[model samples]
Target: MADKEATVYIIDLGHSMGEKHSGRKESNLDFSMRYVWDKISTTVAASRKTWTIGVIGLRTDETNNTLDENGLEGYENISVLQEIGPMSMSALRELRSEIKVSKTKQGDAISAIVLASSMIEDFTKKLKYNRKIILVTDGKGAMDADSLDEVTEKLNDVGIELIVIGVDFDDPDYGFKEEDKPKLKKKNEEILSRLVSQCKKGVYGTMAQAVEELSVPRIKPVRPFKSYDGPLTLGDPETYPNAMSIAVERYFKTKLAHPPSASTVVVNNAPSRSQVDDGDEAIEDNGNGLGAVRQVRAYKVNDPDAPGGKRDVDFDSLERGYEYGRTVVPISDMDESITNLQTKKSFTILGFIPFSSYEPHLSMGEAGVIVAQKFNEKAELALSSLVNALYELQSYAVARYVNKDNQKPFLHLLIPDPKLESEADCLFDVPLPFAEDIRSYQFPPLDKVVTVEGTVLRTHRLLPTPDLSKAMSDLVDAMDLSKFGKDDDGNPTEYAPIDETYNPTIHRINQAIRHRAVHPEEPLQPPAEILLRFSKPPDELVDQVKKQIDILIKKADVKKVPPKVKGKRKRETVKPISGLDVDALLGQAKRTKIDPENAIPEFKQTLGAATEVKAIEEATKQMGDIVCTLIRESFADINYDRAAAHLGVMREELIALEEPDLYNNFLRDLKKKIYQKELDGDRMDMWRGKIIAGGLGLITDQELEVSSITEAEAKKFEK
Candidate 1:
């Protein structure tokens, strides 16, 4: 089925439906029913094609009146309405009358969905087109969170668009208090938005709005043919105007005459009289005729590899003379050794390169040079490799087409990696000019083209002496160049790999560094530490060491410091140390205590409260410096210039310190969080699948029944 068609299902009826508005005479349910019925009927009548419309109504429980002989229940108590066409307003009226309002339960909305889904299942199977289910209701949804999620998921799975229409949520008359109406409407909007986001093309709106939107049908655009202004001649006549015709004729004759076991003849023969005269006469007969013909001279088509080819062909102009019986020289007779031997023909060499391997930055000229080198050095080996690579790429293209059930001919190219530019250049010195032609070629639409990126090189051609010219020729000749029919969308279908963008080595190195920083490992610890330690010196080294020893002793001390309680009454005030005085004392102490023997005891004695505080401040500052160094070194390793930007030192310093059992707790918490996330994702996926399956009618209530969780189900799956 075409993707454009839409199957719209309009659902109506609910419990609070019957409740009358505070100011209005009509009930919410009555307004919704009439609004939806009128809108759907109008939309159906306006549609160009017969739109399959399924009408269902919702209430709390299933009714015998609604159930058919097949045990399938319709919308509300009436099950589903009978057939209704776009112009069938009476049928819609009849359906409205049949819908009986029942008690609204929490599961009513979900049950209604399940019932509608059942009806849709049958319809979708018969109609493989676009399916849309529009559920028209008031702001109130009776279904619980789990059931709603399940129903929405099912709808999505079946490729059904679920559109919800909430009527009169803002109407104070419909039992919605003026003060709470806005909040209720906002809540409904949020719920609808969340549901729509989960389902493709799903949306919610008022009945009036939805009808207006769905009424507009989409149209497909028409593509016009583009004209080519170049010469319409089949081949280079001056050289081998009739070369292609003769070759084609000979190829057919050989196949017919020889039947099965004939050697494939490489067409090297010059143009015959019959071939050229017939072609010229045919061209002249066309309305846009070639004027008075002059003496036809073969022009030299230069072969880059063969420098010695005679560059000209000669012929009599038709206007000048009706010359006949022109002598022909066979291609085999020409001195094959002469590099400049003129030929009467040209052919297009269509090659395929894997888009993954193609390096867009490498120019055609560069590729030509590489090809030439490879051919010159390793003739047979280079040719074989090129053939194999081309073949593999072609196979992939073919497989892709086949998977899509398309039987069209395609050419897929596996481009060479830019990293292999030097090697490729060395291998194929003279780049085939065709590579440039392809690079400049504009591609078709995305739907018509498929490109696979980031493919790793598996095997390459091994060569002894590469002959660039012969290799290029062999590669060109090996390809099967043939035209095929167009696709359904009227696009010329050919499977060609896209050119791969080149990534600079510097960028790659930077990426590696960034990745390492984010995911540091134990193996990197030593280097990381070295980098940190070398970046800065420990402040007040001697004092810090002495303080460390003293602090450890103090921590070990079971007795507390003397308290100044003074019978809880008389409090003694102590003078604070000034920054200037402390600095002076430290300066004097540093000058006086030069020797370790002198400094050690004095440092210990001076390591009062002041020394301890100083040690902590210095340690924290040093740690910050260390973290910054690690960050800088990381950037440097990747050749990135480190700007003098401040690292959030406080955060890093806090992380660096080994907390009391906090790291262990953090690890446990992290593991739990990861596990929970994974568990949640799996559950979501499962629910999503179930929703789709249910919507498609692939699963029923019996099939969807959840069994008790077993030990196997509880265990996490291994990666």
Candidate 2:
């Protein structure tokens, strides 16, 4: 069922609105009217058949067009342009024609509020709709506080929300003189603030903030995650009894109330510097001639007159024991008992169907509408799982409430992303708005279904379902991963590449459904196949290269020689005793200790150096081979960032070994291999920049002088 709502726009047409407001292209009246129209349009589109919009101009020069609603008459400046009605293109066009700047005096703001509230109340009297009155005005109008209070009481009694968007002042961007702001009536300003506050159902802000807010669809608070344990059956129970006892979870289309916080504050703990003089009093001198002396109090524990004087005790005779002071009591104690709150209901998954088959049902009945996935994590997972599962079983559960008020049914799409199921306690999480809350969610009639190779399609809407299953299979098969990113503990970590735009599974099903509904007349076409193309490197790949180059340049900038290890010195020998005084020196012999620090082990430099050098060369050779393989594989499915990062580490190691020639040669060869691959001009430029940046230190005057040697000559005239 559609969410019913009524929004009545009360636009100010006072002569003051004709004045220019900063940051707006049109006059204040014109801008406010347009903003109101946009808000109405957005509300209508989002709410569909359930929303209605009305327009009421605050001040109108034409006395004949004045409104006489709710028994009040002679409101010469007020005009009822359009009454509340369902939104349509014609209605919006009519509203645009009616809104204009008033050439007469301003209308009574209190009267305008009373009239708008009455109109909204009348329109939403029979229907269960949310009543709202959006007032757009400048603060220079006149109103009595008593009248405002009366209207506020009426609006509150009718449960009508009043949102006041005042074009109170010129925007900072507009170069308006200080004198241009009109002197607003103090009583009118106070009344407007009081009216909005007393109602306690609306918000107040500038037109700019209000206009920005209307651009996006308003959403409710996030429903909590839920899970169920039961058997899920699919198809007709009498004919085909296909069922599974799978642990199921439901996710709602919702988002967190607040954004992930990245705000931080840094504290400066350095002591402040101040001048002090050697005296009992401190002298404070200003730039002026006069100086003031401030008395400084000092305390000495050793003085007998001091509050905490030194204690007298016999230290030698006292027993060694610790002193205990008074025990401190806490202000509050926490209840440590664990409370287990059951926030989910157990429901059986009744049936399952292919997402392609489910697409048409999303746009079919007036009673059932599409429910969009809220968070990106759930959306991305659902699309991926559905597309991939289409290759195998190609079915998702359709759940019904075991204990609910309405007991209505809705499609239950499963998003079996591995990250969601990594938790040990549960299979996955489900979100709320369960069967009790949902009403009239009916699937499309099965008899009218048309199947193209067993995949269901609605006969009324002739559309082709894309072969997502085939595409997903090919994508999985194309992955030839040599390695994955790992943490310091050597555990492989999840790597979500930045270039997710190319992935066909990102919100695939939902986007398709929305597109179909928006253009119901047009036949659905298959989405373009996501072929593994490598003509141009993705933006992320280029960014990765630049980041790697930056790191390498920084490393080369802070290059330092390894600290030298000093060998131990030779040990000195003890003088030999002339005579073996057997009995006398036997005890001294036992007490004598060896000088372990001075006893140095024999050092062999040449052999150790050769062995270390050989090991370095072998490791470098292996890494070089891996780098070359990855460079070639980059044309396929290999991650360019990982390859570049490995190459950067290899370059650093080679530089540490003082193998400048080898490092330069490796870069030159790597460049050739990259160029040989299917790289476009942009990719070629990125590679060139990376090479120049990373190999800046490795360049020598000799290499520069011999740079004239062409690639052909170097290969052909090899010695």
Q: Indicate which candidate wins on TM-score.
A: 2
lDDT of 2 at 274: 31
Q: Give the lowest summed-lDDT range of ten residues in model 2.
A: 598-607
Show where candidate 1 strays beyond 4 Å.
1-10, 18-35, 46-50, 60-78, 83-90, 99-107, 169-178, 182-193, 207-719
Clashing residue pairs in candidate 2 are: 226-430, 250-430, 250-431
Query: 1-719 in candidate 1: lDDT tens per residue?
Result: 22444444444445666777546677776556554544454443333445556665555345432334556533334345543233233344455466656675333444555666656666566557667767776656533345567766787777777777776433233333334564544675566657767777676555444433332222223232211111112244459756221111000100111111222222223232212233323212111111222233344555665559544434431112223568443433234335343332222223334545545454333211112221244443443354355444542111110111223222222233222534331212212334436547676432232337644332323221234334444444433122122456976443221221112233233323333332335232122222233244334433445544444445444376776421121222243555345646567543322132233233223322222344434433443333234333443223111211111222222233222122223223323433464322223222223222223111112322222323342232111
Candidate 2 lDDT, tens digit per residue, 467-585? 33344344444342222335569876433333422333432333344344334466754553332233344455455456444444453354667653222112222335775555356
The count of residue-pair clashes in candidate 2 stands at 3
Please tell me which predicted candidate would have the highest lDDT against the true structure.
2
Model 2, global lDDT: 0.52
Superposed by TM-score, candidate 1 places the C-alpha of residue 55 at a distance from the truth, in angstroms, of 0.3
| TM-score (all chains, Cα) for each model | 0.26, 0.37
lDDT of 1 at 495: 24
**In order, what lDDT does every prediction score?**
0.39, 0.52
